[model samples]
Target: MLHMTCKGKIHRARVTEANLDYVGSISIDEQLMEAASIRPFEMVQINGLRSAQTWQTYTIPAPYGSGEICVNGPPAHLFRVGDLVIILSVGFFTESDLERFQHRTVLVDEQNHLVDVKTYTRQSAHHIRGGEGK
Candidate 1:
């Protein structure tokens, strides 16, 4: 059997724009996406911390170092510029994979630039390795 598990997260990312004109999906800075191991066009769940709103959309890469986190289409109304959000991506894993799996967590500054990156495993839930510059 396969289980759906969080593989990566971009925590406390600030929305830089809300483009209602765009078709759909959230656009993240390519640097931020890479830090979280999020792939282009990968489905991601976004949670707005200020409004408690949730949106599921695919990711699109923004210009590198642009600090962009744009919410597109209908969800644009739900996440306005400057709103803090958490972006999550999940992966399918076998039961055995859980034992060796590591999920990545990326922390960003107000500008949406990655400030920290950590890799954590079930064996070391409290302590994570790897930091800034990841």
Candidate 2:
């Protein structure tokens, strides 16, 4: 998992789901897309592609139930419906939610694109609270 140091107090957060995002108007690899069509977990990556960016979707491995973030890869069925993730917001709570989110997960039937983030939640907090930046 990619690690970023933040200034705010660090609390043990659990991972819920990993969502994939691509740059520009590019779409997931045709083969990977087909795989996801059958099995969401069956995905592949085409590095150096014109219409894609590196992303990794991460999820808690259980036990503590930590947060999950999807980065540097494609979307897959490894995730289920109704999962939680982290939303790194600007302030404690504001109108601009940005890309940072908590308790967000991919929808069951909406994994075709795998980048739709509208289905995510702010963990158990209902909304994103501000944490001091590092």
Candidate 3:
């Protein structure tokens, strides 16, 4: 059996732009993508902190170190610049894979700058604690 598990997360990333004209998808900083091990076109779940809205979208890499987090297409209307959002990507894993599975969480500052990158194994999920962003 395969279980869906979180592969990576970008926590507390602020929206830098919202482009209603674009086709669709979220643009993330290349650095952030690398830190979280998120690949371009990978499906992600975005949760808005203030609005409490959740949506699914794919990721596109912005310039390296650009600190960009843009919402595009119709979803752009649901977000705004400066909104704090959590982006998560998930993948399917078999029982054996879960034994060694580790997920990456990339924490960011208010300005969407990388603060830290944390790795969590299934065993550590309940024990680890941090700021609200995580």
Candidate 4:
């Protein structure tokens, strides 16, 4: 049983069966609709994953086929294609609480997957030790 608190109420959810091959989700209450801003039994895609904080993304069925939407409260900077991001909770945010990212870029593909643009580099200890010895 997973509980998602949103709109000052608690929502109960169930994940009956889940494996690397497939995932199943069900909700017995109406909170799922309010939380995700989508109707019941709708085909939604995971737009982005939430970190250990408040952030999530989901692509809903819009008149234009599909539209990816982002909901952020806490900030995290890691994403890739075909990753299943869980939606922890949802809330309303004021305009002042929103701000742009400093050094990151995110783009969504036609398939509603989020693509992160950043380079990651790893330096060995030998490289740092050589500079320190000099």
Off by over 4 Å in 1: 126-134
Candidate 2 weakest ten by summed lDDT: 5-14
lDDT of 3 by residue, 31-106 (tens): 9999998999999999998899999999999999889999999888899999989899899999999999999989
RMSD over all Cα atoms, model 2: 15.5
lDDT score of residue 12 within candidate 3: 84
Per-model lDDT: 0.91, 0.27, 0.91, 0.28
3 or 4, which is superior by TM-score?
3
By summed lDDT, the worst window of 10 consecutive residues in model 1 runs over 125-134
What would the TM-score be for candidate 4 when compared with the true structure?
0.22
Candidate 4, lDDT over the whole model: 0.28
Give the per-residue lDDT of model 1 (tens digit) for 95-120. 99999999988988879887888888
Model 1 alpha-carbon miss at residue 93, Å: 0.4
Better of 1 and 2 by TM-score: 1
True-structure lDDT of candidate 2: 0.27
TM per candidate: 0.91, 0.17, 0.94, 0.22
